[model samples]
Target: MRQAEKRAIERVASKRRNKNSSSSNDEFEAEHICIRTCGRELKCGKHRCQQMCHRGPCPSCLEAIFEEISCNCGRTVLQPPQPCGTRAPECRFDCTRPRPCGHPQVAHNCHPDDLACPKCPFLVEKGCICGKKTLKNQPCWFEEPRCGLVCGKKLKCGTHSCNKLCHRPGACEDEGISGSHCQQLCGKTRSCGHLDTERCHAPYPCKEDKPCQAKTFVTCECQHRKQEVKCSATKIEPSPQRPLLKCDDECLRLQRNARLASALNIDPQTHTNDHVPYSDTTLKLYRENPQWAHIYEREFRVFAEDRAEKRLRFKPMKAHQRAFIHSLAEDFGLDSESSDPEPHRHVCLFKTPRFVSSPMKTLAQCAKICASQDSSTQQATIANDATAIPYNALLLTNPQFGLTVEELDAALRKEYAAHPTVKFHTSFLPSDEVVLKGSGTWTSQTLEASLTALKSTLQHTVRRLKLAENVFLCSVDDSLNVLRREGGQAQREGGWSAVVGRSTGRIRMPRDR
Candidate 1:
């Protein structure tokens, strides 16, 4: 047959098969040669059919609807494969858009990007940076809520304050933040009469970092000795008392001469100019006496030189001798006091109380020196005297009224003048009371009698003086009372006492008799 008749016959048969088609296969028969894709829109409005042209409805839109559905802030987003027209899941996020007032946006459901964010609803209470005032329930939009108060905080200079409004930016002295500090120069004059080379400050002294650089003339107390020193050595005006600056050997010699002249009842200048204040006869008299002021002066020199000797006691001397010794001690910068009564009166000198940096080493050296000096026969006599006392000392304490060393000495002498051999000394306690320790060759009966006499005398003295009630220092009436009250034993067999050594200027161990 011809080509035309063959084409016409195939078309007629294809139409007849389509018209009589019963299976789904016949529907796809047209799709085999169909090159056009299914362009029909699917349930997802964003994507269309992606399969080749088909005879029936397109398969469920498989062209994954990859779309980004986000909240208004873009913080929350629906990931890929999301269906078209699928509204974003309920957005539970706060708006992240920049607010005009710089405050955090309020919490709200996500909406279109074009929609404005919700207004901030937070109200805050804030204090001024200086902490002097507070703003109540300030709106969130009003950031850094500042009060009307000024920032009166002191600057680092400590002399000025930050005068800017509270809540101002940056540090108090930052130039960029319009803050300022004390810019005034220190116009105050230094001890050298030169202006201070520093800014204004609170402390009157020159700053440690910037010590006074000028030099000034410093003179001794008598103005006889002058030396140039840094202005810092001289205290700022209004406090010119600098005794240490006046410390000179010449000044000390002059002071000593003045004191000597006063003691000798001579002119100060005359005494100072004299080569020898005392004549050879007077010197011989002091040497022979052994308890004279000259002998005590020599002993005081030894005590002053010894760092270990904190205190020194001399043999009994006359009142004038003790007074001379006290004046001499003043020259040596030692504290002197006369203790004990009448014929037993003596001078005691004490070194200034100071912190010993190396007490153990000093004490060790002192012990060594004392040991080496033990070869003297006089030292042996003093040792024997201390041993003789042993524990035969009686302690008389006065609690209500304190007595000076001199007062105690006088009182003891007047009270026990009959027992002249009974040597008594006062303790070095700071209390306003006396602790008189008496030592001698005492028997049990003698000790009891002495104790009774002391009690009666003390009670009578206290009553006469009108002291406080119950002025008894220690309950020494009975041995049991003494032991129980003061934790001490008063037995004549073996009693303990804080016995002092003899007049050899050597400390000895305390002993119990």
Candidate 2:
């Protein structure tokens, strides 16, 4: 019987050891297993949770523990504090409760500052009523009651309050209760003749309605003055003289014309041709019409002036001059030597009918008479010798006249060879005149003979030329006598009697038998 009992006690002790060992193993596993979300050992060897560690105890285990140690205020308990004096306790509760809040003492393992706890009404939330989180214990509706959906609206204070949850328009409840009474005191007389006493919210008993007396007025169109009387609104008729204010087209035209005339240096009032002093009418026209000045100057003025000058200044030769020119034409073989003579290719030497006795006066007249002849007539001369003999003769037989320089030179050389004693110098003139200057001893007979020989040579050597009609030789004794009489009178008046005597003395008189 004693052996049986000992065996039973040994069995009981083995069972007890097995139970304790199992419990120890479970506790050890629980401690060793990682609770962090990213830990490798998230679950015990049983793989029950089958999820990563969430940086702490598993939510199911934490929930069970929270239930076990939760405060009546519905907040989960925090870790216990360290013992006093051992080290400053790391209070697990994050209570930020101020002394004025009068909150209950925070329980151990409880999060005194856990804002998400709804049961503890004294513990204000961490943020405003707009659901924003903050570090301070700010009442959700401190300024005004609002939520996230109602924040940012215009409030009674004419400003935007905190854009937080639980905030609303108007002062908060506590603020309203402190200053709820109206401060305004009315002072209005009542119908009973006594002064009424009431707050600003009460109505005044002595108010009356009155019509608007705002006066309106009208003024001149110029708006320089105003009056209480209504002004005539009949479209403010324009003044009678308004039509005369503007200048007419005719006036404008006259003004423009005057301006144009003034710019051109012309007188607008003077319509007569005498207004233009310039002998050149084309120039006068240009000055008169300033508007067309550029066109006239560029295209027409030059050509017109040239045409007028050619006509008025360079007139064709007169009949007497033509006859004299014909004589020269005959002498140069211009008239009868060739069947078709080149026009204006003739040169002439003749005595001017007006200055035969006074060669000095003939110089100016010579240019005038020469210019009157054909445009192609190269040069001309007037001699004052009594025999009407030419002392200087101009010969115009150039290449244009079909007479080459060699042919002219050959003809001249042959003539000079025939009259070797005639001491004369010959030169080619730029005016196409072959000048022949001789000593005073050369008489009309010798000059005639030399000219005849030259004519013969030119006719023979030059081709397609006529030396008959284009040549001329004439005497103007009558014309010379008239000029001499006039010159004598002028000289006598000027006290030049000696010059007159010397000049007139050279005139030969006819002797009778």
Write one digit per residue (lDDT tens) for candidate 2, span 1-513: 668856765776777667767783555422233323343432222223434443556433111221133343444444443221221223445444443446563434334343333333443645444443343555533543233453444333332232334543353322343342333333343332222234333322323122212222333322222344311121132111211123445545555664665588853344442232222332333334445433422322233334222111112333333343343222222221111112222222221111111112121233334335533343232223332333233233232333344544555575567666565444443323233443336775676566555655544543344421232222112112111121112111212433355446354232221
lDDT of 1 by residue, 1-513 (tens): 468756865786787677658555554544234446688987767678876566887666555557787776677888987655566666676555666766666666666766666656677776655567787887765556667666767765665566678666555553443223466555455554455657666445555344555544445544335455555524434233333455567667766765665687753244322233333333433444545443555575567667777667676777766666665555455556665345456665656421111121222233344445555767688655533432323344433344345654665566667566566555432222334555578764565456555656755764565442322323222231232123333323212232222224444343221
**Candidate 2 error regions (>4 Å):** 1-394, 397-407, 437-441, 464-513
Per-candidate total of colliding backbone pairs: 2, 43
lDDT of each: 0.52, 0.35
Off by over 4 Å in 1: 1-63, 66-109, 112-116, 121-124, 168-170, 174-198, 201-513
